[model samples]
Target chain A: MAELSKTDQVEDLHLVNLTKRFGEVAAVDDLTLTIPAGSFFALLGASGCGKTTTLRMVAGLEDPTSGSIRIGDKDVTRLRAFKRPVNTVFQSYALFPHLDIFENVAFGLRRRGVKNIKPIVEAMLELVELGHLARRKPTQLSGGQQQRVAVARALINKPDVLLLDEPLGALDLKLRRQMQIELKRIQTEVGTTFVHVTHDQEEAMTMADTIAVMNAGRIEQMGSPAEIYELPRTVFVANFLGQSNLIEGRVSGAGEMLDVAAHERSFRLPRERSSATGASIILGVRPEKMTVLDAPDAARVPEGHNVLSGRVTDVSYTGVSTQYLVQASWGQELVVFEQNLIVGDRCEVGDEVVVHWSPRHSFGLDGNEDIHAGVDSAVLALESVDSAPAAGDGE
Target chain B: MAPVLPSAAVAPPSTVAQRRSRTGYVLLFPGMTWLAVFFAIPFVTLFVTSLQTPVPGKSGRYQLGLEFGNYATALAEYWPAFVRSFAYAGIATLLALIIGYPLAYFIAFRSGRWRGLMLVLVIAPSFASFLLRTYAWKTILADESPVTSFFNALHLLPDGRILNTSIAVIAGLTYNFLPFMVLPLYAALERIDPRLIEAANDLYASPVTAFRKITWPLSMPGVVAGTLLTFIPAAGDYINAELLGSTKDRMVGNAIQTNFIEFRDYPTASALSFALMAAILILVFTYIRRAGTEDLV
Candidate 1:
């Protein structure tokens, strides 16, 4: 812990108009972002979305085709990876196969000519709860233990910024969850800026203090996890972060509360929540925000709630919440998630239902963009865990 | 009924296991027979021959009596040749490693699409007969050739000649066994994950430091395998010395060949051959132990 406190000066990481191109294709297009000092920030995106590339550029592993990177007042765009004040926990862990866990953790210190390294390495290993396994080679340890060693290897260096490129991608679901919490705890203890790159929305939301959603090498939205999830500015962000029911609508009026017309019915969207200035818009609402009521219970619906009538096309009775796909009169399907609190009031498939949510829960985006922009990629990201190449970022 | 059922299941699996083991023995029969006939019997014959004493005053004739003194006399007389053989082979192996490692590293990490062509080129020289290749070097390093003339102009050749010298024999040995050095090194180096090197670099290691810390250690298997492949055969090879070297550079292989073919000293030749094998085995065992590559090899 004393060794971790050596980095007393906290510095923000800034990527100013960074671009990396592989021949004709721009892997990371003109991107600019500022990660605040000492925050657990996440670059959330699907595979090949340039999130890993951005992390590598910050780590100085990959040189930017254009633009500069800065840590506090120092511009480090031309610095070599070893010379930079940054270290990366690679996606594959990439632990030194020949070195045991202790030597692996002490590698950076030894390279920098640190005279006394045993106590620092021991403390770092203890922080990762891997002190007993310090004598083991990377292959001798299980996946989770090796992952923590990878973290300790990078963390002991105490760089101004620690870049994580899908560091937990190789773990199984349960281990991934556990490591996410473990990594967050370590990051909090060290108080170093941790920029995590991942494609899992839940992992990003659970661990990161701020999230920047990347799409095709650009930041689509950057905010706190809740801010991006609740008020996504683009169709890609709206669909990529989580499932959203986007209804094509027209903004007939505007003010503190803007009026929208869709499927021959009027709906209200809070003015500040809308990112669209034109008449054409896409109204987005989270599935969990909408309440699914049987057609018979429509009379019990509260006032000031936007209502739509549909028949339940699908009902998935998951333990915590029942997800319902409601096909509206316009033939567009909208999903609604209802908590499984009242078991007898469940809406079976094919039941006629009314979906209602308050105007505060809905956000509006430009209608011109593709409504399914990030939908397929989000599903693909979920299905293909760790399928992305560990070495080649954004390839 | 429960005991009977468990025994019945155990009985079938045990029978199956016996049958599998029997099949394995049957499958191993051909290989065992081949080794016994080709390797084991010849080795036993050689060992017996090494102990035979020559009939007094009769050239190429030997008695069936055990004469372990043949080994003592062989080592006593030709110990210089043995030393020369090991030194020349050691030097050649070292030179090949120095030249082959960077080539192998390039082929594995940096050559990209050209790696296949480079590997083919490494083995291409072996397509010709090894004797022909050694003879080609003799011509290349002859007194009137460009190589000799160039070295003579630079005063690099001590005796104003490149052929009929220890340098020529060592060079020939190095050239002939280089592919053996390169191929194993290439395999081991190529199998290393590139990310490990990048990880080293990211952890504040310069490129050179990364190579020392990560690349060199990981490729130790290749180094051990390549050096053994080059050194072992080079030590016992007579072709290079016969063609490129003079009497002063004669190695143990030359002594064994002359004792067997020309001098008709079967006991001495057999003794020399067995001694060479024993020496190589000891050296390679110690080397493997020192390199700590039991698991890797």
Candidate 2:
């Protein structure tokens, strides 16, 4: 183990082409990432997408089949979990039930043969705002309180990096959101690199400085939250982060101005966002970016806009916004989210409407890729598991 | 969120609930009565027997009275047997714990699909008669047995004779009660979440330290239960001492048995039995207190 003094400074966590194989299945395959010191990075993926497996590999809980892990200048690939300068806030909290909150937080320090850790643990508890409950056992606290203690327990060790494996998974929705904010605050205050693995897209977007979207044991995209949301490069990334309306089109013009013809309509694309000139592509647009208009007022669309006339198949009022499913006359249904400022202009199902958006609001993806490739694996897995019983009942 | 309602409106419902609770007590009556008859009645008889006055010249004749001096006589005459009984039981329990803890840990965590088979193997010995098993140990530890001969040749045994000794009695006790120790330990260790151990490792505790700070402490409930299971029976046991031990190794159970069946000294036997029970109870209470596991039961 490297001397503790040498590891005092913040160190970047690096995973170099790590691969973990369980039997014939690869859980995490050739995953390489460098999380800069003091950055909150998220590995976002649905269940079985290798996000948790990657985090466990970095935490030294799981041994990679090949490749190395480094913290700062030290190679800790073969190091025992205890010898590494890292800690994790487990999803179950995993707090020592036999110990009080103070002792649970002080456990790591005491294990390293450090005495007089009372003040350090007390300060950490205060940072997590759990100082008042120091004397209570973990079982006595609420789930959220215990979660904070798990965080404090890891943070008090002052490791080079902190790994959180879906730390808010067990909490209720409200508590999860509150703790998301709390986690960000603690990360900022401690200035420790945090590698948070979660399937919640909103959580990743809200808390992470950078997020790597993983799928099928590989990273689909890695970028800032806004960058990932604004310009998803793959069908998976475009669909996984949020709802994206994809319209198949072929690039008809290239150079300073690009044009795409799809569904018997010509749409202009921004020059800077042009892909292969002659290739078929899928134009992507956010639900909120598409505006819905009454079909009778189709001429209201501006000249430089991409427009499609359709009938409203579904209209869902959701407080701040109303979602409209507009089925274009030529084919395909597109989702549009309109602000609910004018309640009097609400459109019912089967109402004729026109959906239009500016050229800049859209991005393009390879038309060859499966449009539903990035749908949540959790939902897909549940469907398969439910299929057996459903088939039995049918028989 | 709902406000408190008037007690008058709640009284009718609570009256029916109270009647249901009475039915629950009625359902419990048969089992409670059976315990009172079979267990409580015998205990009272035993307590009275412990205080009986034995007729000076009549064999097996005792008059019920406050003859507390019988307890003094039993203690004064058989103090060594009482002490030896506890020492043997304590040593056997300790040995069982030492051997069973790792066995249980392996069966619980490392056995994988073999866990069921391993558990069956641990419990398989209890299928046979305990007396038959103790006699089997007698043959194994005999001077001419291969095990004893091997030990003699290896100089592990100073003398080739082990059949009629304290070591043989303790060995018999340990062997007989091993499953009792292993099962409870396995149950407790199995219930522990593996993540707690991994979390300990992530927090910079070495495997040994993790065991000490997490695994061992969490397994205390099982340790307490297993030790009590092994020790309580081993303390009252006479078959092992009679089958494998000499007169010098005779325990309190053997003395009580001899007094009751051979000497016909019912008062003395009852006194010795009561003393053993009282001692075990006190020791167990002190132990549970010291181990800080009173809540386990």
Candidate 3:
């Protein structure tokens, strides 16, 4: 670990008004971002979202069509990839097939003409916990092991920032989970800035301290994982991060709390949570945030909670929870996830029910945007419902 | 109630395994039989003929007797031809590699949409007969041809002539076998993952270093295959020398052909062929061993 700390001062990566165009299509539009030093940051998006394009610009692999990039005080906009103090863990791991693990890890050090390479290489192999397999070629190692070698190779250079482009995209689900924690632990131990690019929301939430949600070559939102998840600013972020029940409404009152009316039902939205200034708005609530109770037990609902009466149209029993699709009186179906704590008094399909949640859990967005802007049609087709948990519960 | 079949009616697993192995051998019958009949029999006959002695006072006739002295006499009398053949072939192989590697690399990496057209061009010369192509070169390098006059003006040719020399023969050999070198080199260079080069560059390697470290090592299989394909055929070839070189520039193949066809010395011809085959085999074995492409070969 001591040998790995070659950089004394961590430098923030600054990408200012960066743009890249392939023919007529702008792969990365005019975008500006500042990733803080020594933070585990993630660029979360679906395929073709330009997350990888942004990372390649930072790594100096793709020249920006315009604008400049900087590391702290020095501008690196025109610097060649080899001249820049940046390295990337490519999506395919891209380990040299001819070089064994030891040589692969030693490549950077040797290229820089470091005299004492053997010890440094040995130390790097040990850092990745791959010392025993130093003599083995890349093809001989498993997927996860090759991933660690890729990390070790990039990290040994002591780069100012480490760019990972879908580093865990090739692994199985179980191995991906294991490597997620492993990568987080390594980032913590080395204290190097990690900018991970991935399409998996859960992976971003699990490993990254800050998550930037990207869509169609633009940044929709950037914040801590929890902040972005709980208070998404755009419709794309809300749907892409996880499932959100968006209800179209009109603002009836404005105050510390905004009263929104939707289909003859009034719901309270905290004024701080609403980003829309117009009378028309879209109120969003996560499926797991709302509770579904039978009509007879409606009295037990919290007093100050926003309530909507509906009929349970579909019921799905997952291992940890039961998902109920309740069709509101307005004919819009809302999803509610209830923990399976009580087995005997469960509401069945076709039962009259009331879905309610606190005002704090509701978010407001502009009604001008498309309601299905970020909903993946393929996933929606598979579920036959508007909002089901896109992935496993992160809480 | 259905009746159960007896256990004796079932085939044993070991018998089934044996039948599967038998099928494998049966599948190999045609290829093995063809090699044994055409290749193995001729090779054995050639080796036996190399050791036969000439019949007393009989022209172009041999007796079935052990005459190991034939090998000694062949090596002593025609050692210069053996040396010249190897030297010319070695130079031609080296020249082909130097000329073909860059063409292959460009087609593999930088040609982009024109890759298909370029590869077709590399193989297009092979569509014409090799002998015709060599004859075309003879015309191109004739004493009064434009190419020879151009080189003469540059004073690059000290002898003031391009035809009937070692250079002409070597150039012919290199030109005839260039596609062999280019195709294999292109295949190997094309198979390399571009990301490996990018990774090297990302790790602070300059483009030259990346090629030296990543590109070169990965293309070893192609280089080994290309050199072998070029060198082996060029070594035993007599057509280029016979067409483009003088009497003093003749190779072992010419000597063997002359001994058999003109002088009707069957024993000496067989001995010379055997000696050349053994020499090429040793050179190739040593080359493969040194190149360290054991797994590839």
Candidate 4:
């Protein structure tokens, strides 16, 4: 399990055991991450997950209590923020009110006393398509224009690392989506290391080459958007990214492969995992993974799979897709999605159907059997328990 | 700029932007008119007065004679006073800047509620009698006072005499105007988005470099405002000189007051006031013009 620690496979900017605390509470704690260069890396998290704190440390706004931050071979732990080869596009865009678009873009270069600034400033502005609006003051510019200027301001400095702190959060949804693509294209063209901080899962999904999902004050998982979406390592990660159904099950049998048991059914799990039998697990699968089968799904499918019958409790049209909320035999509600066409066979509410999905599509926690037993008994006893009160009255 | 109501091109209707602009103009006119009347009229009056002369008479009284002699003589007679005022005010402004900057930076960038409380303290003396504060400093610096006693205990001054000197006048000026210097600087520094300083540091600016490039430049509006405030009042101040100093330390205001109160010479007093006003107009206007607050704001 610890073998990966010995090998250094990541590049971009590596934060080695970074930790920061304000008074007593830890803001960023023992966080180690490697953001590869030429990748639009997003630190995706909820508020207070230490994502912003981590970004700020790299931006040199907050000094880490202990850690070494290296951009390539340069150790920038002790370097002043301005002296570091990184620049930030703040959440508010923070354009200097005094300067016009051109001067605002030229601010960093001028601060360093660059010998020739006009050509580079022009190029950066042109790159952001702001050449026509160069003479306009920040006040006269629209939100999108100002956002581009903020990007141009950071990029004109030719920093080794560019940090974007929710750069598109202020924009409308349509503009934000447009900027996401624009940001990705610009990052690719420049090949500069971009560290973007965002709370929007969709924004990270659309633009990021690598995404680090953070929870509490740590990285829940760091991988590509697809990897995190399809193969979340924790229940928290699975739920945070998108809608997921959690099914409690126990590894009933195991040798070359494992068998997962929930309620009265025994289902074989894929053979990749080496965890022992009778281990408690929480099976996870995306809503799109579950299919509504017309016929009764086979009760005892051969090893390496399973099936369940349920009633479609609800149906919702989401324009591009239709969603079905199905209650399984174990009384667990599972979400399923079907592609919506101009004309197609769509399941109606209250339709009895088989909820089917591959075993490989589901991810399970390694251990803790009590959760499975707790959930199973409570669900199985639900109907009998309700009738017991009536039976007691009759007696 | 979200308009209160959307403007429809095809419909005949009033829009928020149009209504707001109208109301804004209404609100703006009064202050603009007040400035035009008070500030604008006085400067015109002073300029016109500078050209008028004292008609030569045995009674030392005159009619409005259109001659520049009054201005010429006032300048020639009070050249030393003007120079002394300049030197004193210049030194006081420099000292005020040195002292006020750290106070301003602390209040603006460091303190929170304390910033507001501290601001009240800085400007508190102005709410009291200005003459009393100057006179208090005179008493404190006296040979018999506790300050002199402390100096005497230290054996720092042989005679331990601080009253009735140039030092006392400058001290009075600095003490009286320290708040003016701090307030503008505090405002300028406070408004300077802290993110810029952080951005500078992230770009690898050291503490000193950040101050030099970001903090200092950003606070220039305050520096300019403070210099003007300290200098203009200190140059024209007669109370400190009268209360705390002898003949050598008397500034331009003392000379003007002597003409008006002692000599009963209206023409010379008006000429002196007009001369000082002109000099101040030139100096302050030039400085404010160069301060470039338009860009910073």
Pick by lDDT: which candidate is best? 1
Q: What is the DockQ of each candidate?
A: 0.61, 0.54, 0.60, 0.42
What lDDT score is found at residue A329 in candidate 2? 84
Score candidate 2 by DockQ. 0.54
On the 0 to 100 scale, the lDDT of residue A49 in model 1 is 93
Each prediction's Cα lDDT score? Answer: 0.91, 0.87, 0.90, 0.77
> Regarding lDDT, does 3 or 4 come out ahead?
3
Off by over 4 Å in 2: A1-8, A271-278, A341-348, A376-395, B1-17, B295-297
Classify candidate 4 by CAPRI docking class. acceptable
- Segments in model 1 whose C-alpha atoms lie over 4 Å from true places: A296-300, A341-343, A348-350, A386-395, B1-13, B295-297
lDDT of 4 at A350: 80
Ranking by lDDT: 1, 3, 2, 4
- Highest TM-score, which number? 1
In the order shown, the chain A TM-scores of the predictions are 0.95, 0.91, 0.94, 0.86
Q: How much of the real interface does each model capture, measured as fnat?
A: 0.82, 0.82, 0.80, 0.62
Candidate 4 per-residue lDDT, tens place, B92-121, comes to 898899999999999988898787788888
Best by DockQ: 1
The runs of at least 3 residues in candidate 3 whose Cα sits more than 4 Å from the true structure, single-residue gaps closed, are: A252-254, A296-301, A341-343, A377-395, B1-13, B295-297
In candidate 1 the C-alpha lDDT for residue B292 amounts to 93
Docking class of 2: medium
lDDT of 3 by residue, B241-261 (tens): 999999989999999999999
CAPRI quality band, candidate 3: medium
